[model samples]
Target: MTIAIAPIDPVGRAFFAGVVSGIDLRKPPTAAEVAAVHDGMDEFGVLVFHDQDIDDEQQLAFSRALGPLETATGDIAAPHERRVSMDLNDISNLDKNNKVVARDDRRRLFGLGNQLWHSDSSFKPVPAKYSILSARTIPPTGGNTEFADMRAAYDALDEATRREVHDLVCVHSQIFSRGILGFTDFTEEERAKWAPVRQRLVRRHPRTGRLSLYLSSHAGGIEGWPVPEARAFLRDLTEHATQRRFVYAHVWRPHDLVMWDNRVTMHRARRYDHTAVRDMRRTTLTNEVSSLDQAP
Candidate 1:
């Protein structure tokens, strides 16, 4: 079956967002269709595929068409045992009772960190290249996920700022970010598990050859700057890049699959009611190496 691509927002501003339709997820895409999706990925950093109606098995089959999937790790609980594949990261707030956890629940508090803008797996040695999140259930209002076009954010940077950051590197760590949100009581083992990784401040898209700002909440500090100064700079850059003009907030529908190029975008989950159930599964595609420059 043929696939269709339509821009979700203005081409000049939100160039990296689009809607893809007319393809069956129950079966894998043809070679031409795969290429079309890749082209769409390179051109538009995020593609929304609606009404996919795919289960974890179908989702894995489709994700394999794009690249190798990242294996899930950690002590996270599995809510939808049968429907949610073991390989997929469960991003839901529901407990075994199929109800949202208490407001002070550890899982609920931990997830609050997602409200900060970040790319998937930025803290890992080998970060994720792309992330596909499928909506199994959603609330009636709020909980919209917002994405920033980092390429556009980079282009909007003044010449002096661009020159200053062109050769810089930022040390990123989940510990640093989570600590900022008062989740600092992590064990020594957890701290070691999330040790800092250095990443280039600017990323050049391997396919499109376009440059994008790779800012993230995981940013600990600039490589050679003082703690206060580095944090100030990082905060300023994040504020600049996440301006409203560079963002698109997606209101999800059940069965919607939203795939995003983590290399060129930052996303954050908006706040929703603490008592409402919200279930989502994410499959992350791993890069060949820890750094984008060494990505396959």
Candidate 2:
């Protein structure tokens, strides 16, 4: 059956659909809806599903329908499920159960940049292909997921800037990034585990071969450049890509599910009260690739 999709933002960067259209996400979607979602996702980076009751099995099935699930690495992925794909109900700095810790954890780490804007899995050797989030519960104030269009950003770049960044490889580091923020969750063991990884600065979509802004907050420095200079350049590039003109902010509702292409977009959550008990379930899909750890 066809789903009614409505564009949520001014630029129509997002489209809203109902998962409760009574089709079981556990099973495969008809060819038509799959085609439609693919089309919609290309036009509107973020696609929202309203009021779909799904369990882990169903969620997995739904996510895998898009592609193979992304295998999370790093210490945060130590959780029984996944760091990027699973949702935490609470994100307080003081809570031992908190997946990630920081003061105003929701604002600083969880929501601050969650709302800021960067592509998913852009930091990994093989970055994420798609991410689907199911919001089971939401806070009363300030919890939104915003997406900036990397493809749009790339298209908007001055021809010179595009040429300059195109072939450059940027280094991505969780250890260096959290350290920069003074967040000390990673042990020396963790640091050693994460050697640096470099990805092409301008990402080419695996399917469409479209170039997008591949840099993100986790991007530590450039592969061959001096650290400070690389950091400065990445910061400026992010600032340019996330301009108001290229973004679409999603105000989430309970049972809202959003899926986006990780290669062409960046997104993060907005701040909400930690005490408010917000929870969500997420699943990330990976671009088809073989598995093996690599050296820096």
RMSDs, each prediction? 2.4, 4.9
> How many clashing pairs does model 1 include?
0
How accurate locally, in lDDT, is each candidate?
Answer: 0.83, 0.64
lDDT of 2 by residue, 1-296 (tens): 55555666544443322122434464667766667677667666667777776665677777666667765453243455333334222222233454334455433452333434556655566767678877766778877777778888888889999888877877776656565556656557767666566677776664466677776787888877998999899888988888877677778777677788776777767777756756666677776641122111
After superposition, candidate 2 runs with Cα above 4 Å error: 10-28, 74-116, 290-296
Q: Where does candidate 2 clash, by residue pair?
A: 85-282, 114-268, 114-269, 115-268, 118-266, 119-266
Per-residue lDDT of model 1, residues 112-171, tens digit only: 778999988888778888899999888888899999999999999999999998888889
User: Clashing residue pairs in candidate 1, if any?
Assistant: none
By TM-score, the best candidate is 1
